[model samples]
Target: MTEQTTGRLKVRLVDGLLILIMAVLAGCGLIYEYLLSHYAGRVLGAVEHAIFATIGIMIVAMGFGAFAARKIKDAFSGFAWLELYICFIGASSILFIAAAIGFTFHLPQLISDTFNLPADVLPRGGWVEQLHQIARYLPYVSAACLGFFIGIEIPLIARVREALYQKHLTHNAGTVYGADYIGAGIGAALWIGWMMSLDINQAAVITASTNLLIGFLILLLFWQKIRWRLLLTACQLLMLAFVIVLSAYGQNWMNSFTDMLYRDQVVLQQQTQYQQIVLTERNLQLNNNPTQTSVLQLYLNGRLQFSSMDERIYHEMLIHPVMASAPKHDSVLLIGGGDGLALREIFKWPVHSVDMVELDPMMISLFKQPRQFLPIRLAKQVIELNANSLSDERLNLMYADAFNQVDQLVAQGRIYDVIVVDLPDPNHPDLNKLYTNHFYTRLQQLLNADGVLVVQSTSPYHAQDAFIAIGKTIADANFSAVEQYHQNVPSFGQWGWSVAVKQGLPVSERLKHSLAAQTMPVIKTQWLTWPIVLASFNFPQGFYKNYVNIKVNRLGSQQLFNYHDQAWRKQQGMVNLNSNQQISP
Candidate 1:
């Protein structure tokens, strides 16, 4: 005995449960990232502002939670009840949100709008309004509860340590931090592997159980008397169990309703770590064989990414200009694009070898196996992805790394005769870095003097300013000049692309349209004419010109958290569905 009451053996239990509770608290951050993106995509008319709007609100709420922790007068036994409350909040979160959106917003919109019902009678315009309400405020609530608990645990564990033996706050903090990091790692793995598959209801149940069990363990270790507060906690959980069952059942109706609202000829839907991958088809071109039908499209995170049919416009734009300008085509590197469209273009050249490096093994697996992709071409040579391998000698030409991922390759001093960057929009800051001044300068360093780099900028017509900003961003990065172009693709609406070189002109500007379009295995975009090329750079004076002031950084920066990404779909005038819940974050 270190001259304390029998109260001191409580140390081990409090420390262990502190680890567990903090694990649950840290869960909020990762889960927030995934759910914020998912919910924003689900809602119609959501802007780039919403991602920032939600994140800011949640962090503020966490501060509020830390402030509120000062008011809790009772310690130890009373604090144990807070763990139970945390469990309840964590478990019910996904269910409450998904069910609310699925039923309240999505279902009624499809059914009522299709049948033509009165808005006064039902929650018309569906759950987008409701989900907006949730996304705007609910995150704050989540942070408050999670943060309050976390703040208290720091002091509670400190009290336990002081009660046992004298250790400085710094030493205790390190131990707590070590345990928290390890627990968060475990939780992240479980979240990706298991929670991703479970429906919103089941996800809640699992989350709730993890929290409640942790709470029970905490109480058992610290509090000897099982009081009224513990009983209340049990009863609250039983009621939540009932809510979970109802919400899960409601979501069944929601899924069908959401499908009809979008009217997707949905080909595939998978939640990968990268983003939500959805493949869809529209029978626009009528054909004799019903089996061999219309165009197939790919959507990532609710935005139209690419279509298999006219994707040639985007891919050809990315490939041909660079290939024609490059000194040699001995070796090539492709990243992120596991779709095999970019690979099809590379094979068109007389290249010695090509390395298709993709981060997600799933994308490569899909291309390699016909059963997985169903008619999609396989990759040339799918290699395991790692940033360290960028220094490898084999690659003479590279495509696939998004602007954010390009930094590592740039730092490695990997040079290429030609570089093709075909990533999703700079709708968020993370994607925007690749288009920034710093990234372009790094890109210029990676390209040989004669090397030409072609970047797939967004639609010149829809997002001309952002497109111009990209051009200027490269100009700021020390590239002498930037070339721009636009092409019509049904799946992507009106899209734009640009090519930048260190010391040479793009082949299109220098040479005439002398090379004839040859028939290829995939679609050939020989239709790329001088008229289209000239018109691409011709922007109306009315276009927004904020590109002059924009600043781009390498990391801990913007996250492209501004440029509204779902632009094309909004341009196409697409609509979305219903939702579940009373609680907002």
Candidate 2:
């Protein structure tokens, strides 16, 4: 009975040690992903190289470490030392990757981005090779140190159990593996949930510091000897210094590198499980500051989500027609349209209450900032809520679930009198889904009686097939439809919109009738004249032939995406993404 009790105690201790090692290893994977995305845009570049490189390096390194694990049979109790070494290696790997790419491509672009210059002026694209070199070298170093310690620690843990409490090696290994699983899960959860909320440099420091603390704690348990306590304290102090110094100086290094790559100011930054969100601020006008104006703007990923100079087109198109079509425009509900442009237009009407439910909080924070175009008045109207919230009796739902076409609201049973599908073209699968027959049918359930739905399809000419598909989908959903074009935005070529309603009426009638009077508080300031209303319907012969007969059974959503992608490939200095083919404003 005494022997069995002692043996069980040994197994528990071994398990604890193994858990610590696994936590450190799992952190490596999390930190690696976070850093890479921050350093490079997730969508662009050769991510395949980094991913394949990480896996290849880790597996190969793990194999070598596994062999080392078997060889260090007698010296296995030194798992504490292995933990300290692996933590250092994992933590330092960040700087290794950063330094490699930092000066090469990223920093130069950051500086250049501060000013707008002619094309062929920016650095050419062969920076991937330098990144490949970094990826090739850094992962091997991390894997060698991480894999070696991880492999060696398991056997060391088993040996310690066998010696300290006389547990068998097999029992020790099994017990330790269980702890390993639990610790890895915890590490993964923590990184995704909280660590990812930080910038890459911050995430790296936090993750590394965590490992160091845990490593010291494990040492305290295993190293009962007085002499080893000094070593543990010294190691902890070293890690503390590492985190503090890196925290202080690391950001400057990172931003410098990023500036070079993007040729823009790397402003607001965060790492998520999937990607890095960077907000860049470019001083469009340096010599003179525009008073009562926003000189700086924010960009997400690489796309220009918002600008201070003007967003009249984005908002006017999204809101004006929806308001023009809706019953009374009393209470409003906006979902996922966080740029505040849609809300800006909504504020133009005598809206009693407005609720905007944006999914990403980070984006909202950026929205609250004062831009020349994004006034506090626009941001104030929002009753900010998440998309999954319920609509009250007051909500005249205004839906804009069209980012990359992955409209979560489409599936969620709800209807609005005014639905504005201001989404990107059918580029990715998610964006394409919003243009599908299934999505329109889902949207049908949410419309109020006699409600009007405005969908921003791609160009009426360039992406004519995609534009046609949107109309067909709305028709398939059993809604009477009318299509229009307005080129208010120069960024996107001529933009398009499809208005689908429960009742068939010439869109021009509803649009004309819905104009706000001069007496209205919001409308007193701006122009919503009947001239703009007349111009919206004056579609050319080309747009008419484009949407001739697009049907559900024959859905080629790719036509729009392909056209846009090809145009993008053409790369004649600019492409319009914000407004459709024919925009009206």
What do the candidate models score in CA lDDT, each in turn?
Answer: 0.55, 0.54
Candidate 1 lDDT, 1-585, residue by residue in tens:
564544455555555657666666456444543454345434432434555555555556556655665665554554566656665665555445544444544555556688798865555443545454564345345545554554465455445545445565557767766665676677678778766654544455555565566556655665653356567557656755755664567445434433443445665656555555555666664556644546656666556666556666667666765676566766554644566667667666776665554555555555444355554321111121111223234433333445545666777776666667666676555566656667677778877777777777776666555666666666667776677766666555667777777876655554233344432223245445434555655555755466556444333454232433434335434332322211000
Give the number of colliding residue pairs in candidate 2: 38
Q: Once superposed on the true structure, which residue ranges of model 2 sit more than 4 Å away at CA?
A: 1-85, 94-102, 106-168, 171-173, 217-240, 251-280, 284-294, 325-328, 350-353, 362-415, 422-439, 456-476, 482-498, 506-585
Best by TM-score: 1
Please give each candidate's TM-score.
0.69, 0.66
Q: How displaced is residue 187 in candidate 2, in Å? A: 2.9
What TM-score would you give candidate 2 relative to the actual structure? 0.66
In model 1, which regions exceed 4 Å deviation?
1-56, 62-81, 104-207, 219-224, 229-262, 265-267, 281-289, 321-336, 373-415, 513-523, 526-537, 540-585
